[model samples]
Target: MSDEELSSYLPHQGDRIRLRVHVRKEEETPRTKKNKLLTVLQEKLEAARKKKTTSKEEHNLEDMRNPHRPFGNRNAAKQNRMIEIGWIHKSNQRSTQIRKNKGGGTRKTEIPRHATKVEIIQQAIGLFFPNGLSSKGPLTNFNFDLWDFADREIDANVTVADMYERTKLPILRFYLATSQKTNDIGNTTDA
Candidate 1:
């Protein structure tokens, strides 16, 4: 008997026939097109940027028009400024151990404009020396000093507001000078 004749008598006779399938392509909407989508997104971003800038400008204008208004009183706002403090040896070399123990890199503190160098040092001590200073510790007989970017030591009496007035920068960067101690062998070491 021929295969076809035998297949027609089998229980799975439909297996002998091959089926053809067709797939339909989905239609693209106006916004689904790449160029159209990008254009729409760009327009939205531009509009948002313009709105934000205009609102800021309008707020500034309002503040200027009524400087004494309690609703927008600048004096009532906190005049805190950001300060970055890092530890460095008196030789100006960065201390890896100190940096690693101090959570790596410079520590930032937000202080009011009227804060003094002494206050900043206290804050720095809290950040780097959690247990506070001790006579038995490495910082014994050592006092930290604040140094500016120019490597000049800042006076303890100077206020942050004065520094800001001179530099006109919102954030100030400074280094805490590590004290050097001489061992019995006459070798200098960083405390």
Candidate 2:
């Protein structure tokens, strides 16, 4: 087989795995709290406006004419204060790409370094088992509670099945072994 064909037949390389993780922007606060603070600020501004209008003769109308000036210094100051207090958080929509390095450490591309091995493993498991253990009867019997602990404890190179095997967890081992046998039998029958 040609190199291209051989490469296609082989399993995907580890470098190909890229996981996106949400990270809060620097100097930004939480969205909900920020919105709330903004609302309060708006109310205060309106109340001040009303008071100014009522006492227009006493104070100059120049400052009240444009509360938000062309440069918006007042608005900017409010935003800065909101960030300082964590009332408004950075946008989490922009995700950072996390790739696992050969040595097992993760490489985060872009800002907000945030992906961990456990998070990546959990994401991979979610992708692998989209419907969770509901569809797989044997898997339902297997202990899934160990996933988080296993992800942390096991070596990065080891496959989930291999990790389960290493644990000598009877339910998981039996399920996987039997499943393999069933697949083998099915293949033979098809042939």
Candidate 3:
């Protein structure tokens, strides 16, 4: 009779369709590696400055301290060299990556860098686990073998189901268990 009334014909056929969805998007501050590192360094410098009783005096830490402590020869040039000036020196060990090979031996491996001047790995998120969701390795203290092996065939967004479809690991535990949620339905009126 009324517009709000549900009719039998309308119930059989779909009267109207309503789409509902909750969309969440996060806008991360796009920070460069150097920018983040420099900010940290600057903070450290500022804190050091604040702690010092001296007025506007930059702390020459190693310079003032008696320099002839170490076992190295007391050459004046090397004395100045101890105080690292502008840049930090990376290890010549070539990329901090080492792996064991077959035949009971070890081999050196290096991942390609984005640039000539080694960009500080400010964000190693996708670099390590592209899946966004961390694997069991990181949770435990176990070493992640993802980097050592070649890239996976599946996309970063691929889940357990996708992996199961591709290869092994069909981890289907809850079937009917998840069909309808089991709950002890309680109400204030019943009480």
Q: Which candidate's TM-score is highest?
A: 1
TM-score of candidate 2 on Cα atoms, chains taken together = 0.16
> Candidate 2 has which clashing residue pairs, if any?
28-89, 29-88, 29-89, 30-89, 34-87
Return the number of clashes found in candidate 1: 0
TM-scores across all candidates? 0.51, 0.16, 0.14
* Full candidate order by lDDT, most accurate first: 1, 2, 3
Q: What stretches of model 2 exceed 4 Å from their correct place?
A: 1-113, 134-140, 143-191
Model 1, 2: alpha-carbon shift in Å? Answer: 89
lDDT, candidate 1, 1-191, per-residue tens: 45567576653645433211111122333435897879989999999999999999999899899977667434325588778887655433444224654443488888887888788877776766656553224555455787875667898888887887687675787776656666789666543
Q: In candidate 2, what are the lDDT values of residues 82-180, reduced to their tens digit?
A: 100000001223312212221112222211113333434444334334465323332333222212232233334554334333554422211111121
In model 1, which residue pairs have backbone atoms overlapping below 3 Å?
A: none
lDDT of 3 at 14: 38
Candidate 2: worst 10 consecutive residues by lDDT? 81-90
Q: Which ten residues in a row have the lowest lDDT in candidate 3?
A: 172-181
